[model samples]
Target: MLSPTLITVALAAAMIGALAGVLGTFLVLRGQSLLGDVIAHASLPGVVAGFLISGERGFVPILAGALVSGALAGLSVQLLRRGAGVKSDAALGSVLSLFFALGVVLLTVAQSQGGSAGLTMFLFGQAASVLRADLLPMAVVGGTVLLVLVLLWKEFQLVAFDREAARAQGLPVERLEVLLTLLTAVTIVLGLSLAGVVLMVALLIAPAVAARQWVRGLAPMVWLAALIGALAGSGGAVISAMGQGVATGPVMVLAAVALTALSLLLAPERGLVARWRRQGAARQALRGRQVLAALRGLEGDHATPDYASDEAMLQAYLGTDAGPALARLYRDGLIRPAARLAPEAAARRWELTEAGRLRVEEGGQHA
Candidate 1:
């Protein structure tokens, strides 16, 4: 029995997630990931500045202020890059610190004026406070952001993968780069407006990272990231509704955290656990092959016939590293061990069963 408000909040969160994912993918692939974080954190001061000037709390003017400030932060980083020798990371860090510091100062000033409880909400975002009125803006902006992202996909890929080539191809590398920065800023600001600057980066980044693990192409990545974002948002909204005083922003972030961890361990090729397992399997196969070659050497059987001679030859080839794996292989019918042949164990060589040869071929494909 979820409320309509909770459902709307979740829908909004999912849209935001999709927008973040779309631009976030490009940011990460282009190695500008930290910039997104910088922009997200930097937007707080803009929000406070907006509130100070407009004397209000809702998204309209505040988000406008956020966009202005966000763009400035993005532009400042670019100016730093062009005007000074400061590297991108340093420039981004400098902007983040300066903007956030300014925000804190503005917030302090605004709080001194009157009831600060309402003003403080922007600092950590009160997503559960979101109403149906907020839906149209999120939908409008989110839709525009995604449409532009898809239309410019090819250009972005070139710039991200090979800047020099994009330049050589006359793809407006520099312009597109700035345009991307602005998009990243906008996307970040959207999340910051809901999740607060502190957790904004998670919303903008986690879904994209998770999506990357699942897809090879850009389109699927964006879609998947959006789905995850929406799910997290909706789930957080539900949690907040049932629990007394549960913060919506933090709950959304926690849901994102779960997805991020799941992707890191379970997502296809790029997952942490998957890679580790692949490496372990590869190492075992290599050792098994070495043992087979060694067995052939000890066999003195020029043609190296079959599985009957493995027991005696295990001593010559199989060692501590392969003992457990080899034993498992034996039980699985991949290999026949020489262990049963005691005397003249040199002739007691292991032989590859059909499964072992297929494994070897599979290894060759990888090579």
Candidate 2:
């Protein structure tokens, strides 16, 4: 039996996560991941102003203000990049610091004036405070963002992967870039109540980063990221409900980070573990080939078809450990004990099989 409040909070957080995940994919692909952080910080002033103007912690006013503030911050970065020739990183940093400072000052002023009791909740978020009334508007905004993304998928993809190429292809790269930025800002605003200003960027970025590890294509990556984000959001909400005085935003961020770590360690083609295994396998295969070629060379030089080399001889010839390679080659039937070929005299020496000789001659390995 779950309370309606918890259900509502979970739903709200899930929607926020899904939206952030989808939009954040583009941000991540465009190498503008820090843009989410900039928007999150810049939206803070708007959040405080929205509360001040409404005289209440209403979701609509706060989100609307945050959207405007975030969009302005995005535009400011562009303007600085284009007009003042400031680097994108510098512009983003400047806007984030400026807006966050203004937000802190406004928050202090609102605190002094006194109707701003729960206003600070937006800083770190209070998902427990979410009401059912917040769901409809969040759904509407999230749905619209998703619809726009669906409609402009290809164009966005093009702009994301290659802006110059998109421009050369006669696409409206600038307009598309601005639209993507707006979508990112809107998504960040939607998550503000769930992940808050401080941790919202993590929610936006972590799912996409994790998703990237598991997928190579953009569409699949976006879908997987949304799923991961939703899971993190709902799971965090449930966990927070189970504990006393636990904040939902931080929990959600931690969940997302955990998912990212798992993806980094476990993804088949791209994970650290997978890459390490592949590299080890490649090194082993190279060593096997080297040992085979060395045996073949030794036979050619000595005019003997069956040249048996001991582990020490192979190690000296290869200038590295040869035990693993020898074991692997023996397992693969590419090499065998020299005693099998010469029962008369042998001191645990190895010789290349016909397959190994053919592999070396062909300059390739067996599948």
Candidate 3:
């Protein structure tokens, strides 16, 4: 029941998402996540210029402008960081703000001139308006970016994980960095028509961040991030098509955020819920061992047949939560109440069973 145009738009968005996800993984690992944001915002001025020069909304021209603008912005950040001694964050922020403001001013001028009326759509993206012509450019650019990433995978990974080591090996670390930055700039440019400047950062980084939580290896993380980003892009497009007045970019970002939240709560090893469960099990095991150790210690110290078996003594020895441990130990035949104890006695004495003594002697209690 879906229309052809809608299908094309969805596919383009997915391609953009997959490309962004792959490149963004390195950005996240290199601690340059904010650099992605800066590149995205910086593309705006070039986009506006592209429209002005072409005098129409042509995907290729606009994309070319975007690529140039984005690269300059990314290079500016690097120069400021390395040459001017500006902090990385400050450089990124300064360039991002400056380019975005310049783009805004150009946008206003173009709007007043009355030739670029539809230019505002690129500000937040209008995926619903994507045409067949848009798909070709997206496929060509996205495919090229992906191919390059694969060809330089080892170099990029080396630089990202350990720059000092890469430099020690004489691996041309600075060239690799610049290449990676340009790659990221291209990605942001490609995504401009789909997710825009602001939402594109979320598209770039969220899937990678989410995938990192579940995966330890770089290869697995990259593929998983691409898959997740594709899903968000396609799903957001579909949802926007079905809804009224809803923007495609924001919806895609929300979908990515939702997946991230799910990963945070449910992923193994690092998830909040998993960590809580593990800690609870560990505490229980520790308490059980403590009770066993306490029972073993009391036998020789007290002359009352075995030792203090009363709730009061156990509580004093192991805090107020000793009852559960005591009950668990008794169930395991590690400890039991002393013989001839009154049923109504408030403080019945207890002793460790033979199994309990052997367990303590062998250090099995620590197990």
CA RMSD of each candidate after superposition: 4.1, 2.1, 2.3
User: Which lDDT tens digits does candidate 3 get at residues 101-123?
Assistant: 99999898888888786777777
Candidate 1: minimum summed lDDT over ten consecutive residues — where? 358-367
lDDT string for model 2 (1-367, tens) is 9989889998998888888888889989999899999999999999999988988888889889999999999878877887899998899899899999999999999989998888788889988778898799789989999999999988998998988999999999878988888988998888887788999999889999999999899999999999999999998898988999899999999999999999999999999999999998887778888888887888787788987776677788889988887888889888888754356644368888898888888998641
lDDT of 1 by residue, 1-367 (tens): 7678778877777777767766777877777778887887778778877777888776777788888888889888988987787898889889999998988888889888875566566667777567788788778877787778778889988888899999998888878988888887777777764688788777777777878888887677767887887777777767776788888888888888799889888987999888999998888767666655554455446565563554534654465455665676677676775454567544434567777666665654221
Better of 2 and 3 by lDDT: 2
- Error of model 1, residue 240, in angstroms: 2.8
Tell me the TM-score of model 2.
0.94
TM-score of each: 0.85, 0.94, 0.92
Report the lDDT of model 3 for residue 330. 80
Order of candidate numbers by TM-score, starting with the best: 2, 3, 1
Please list the residue runs of candidate 3 whose C-alpha ends up more than 4 Å from where it truly belongs after superposition.
Answer: 303-305, 330-333, 337-340, 346-350, 353-367
Per-candidate clash tally: 12, 0, 2
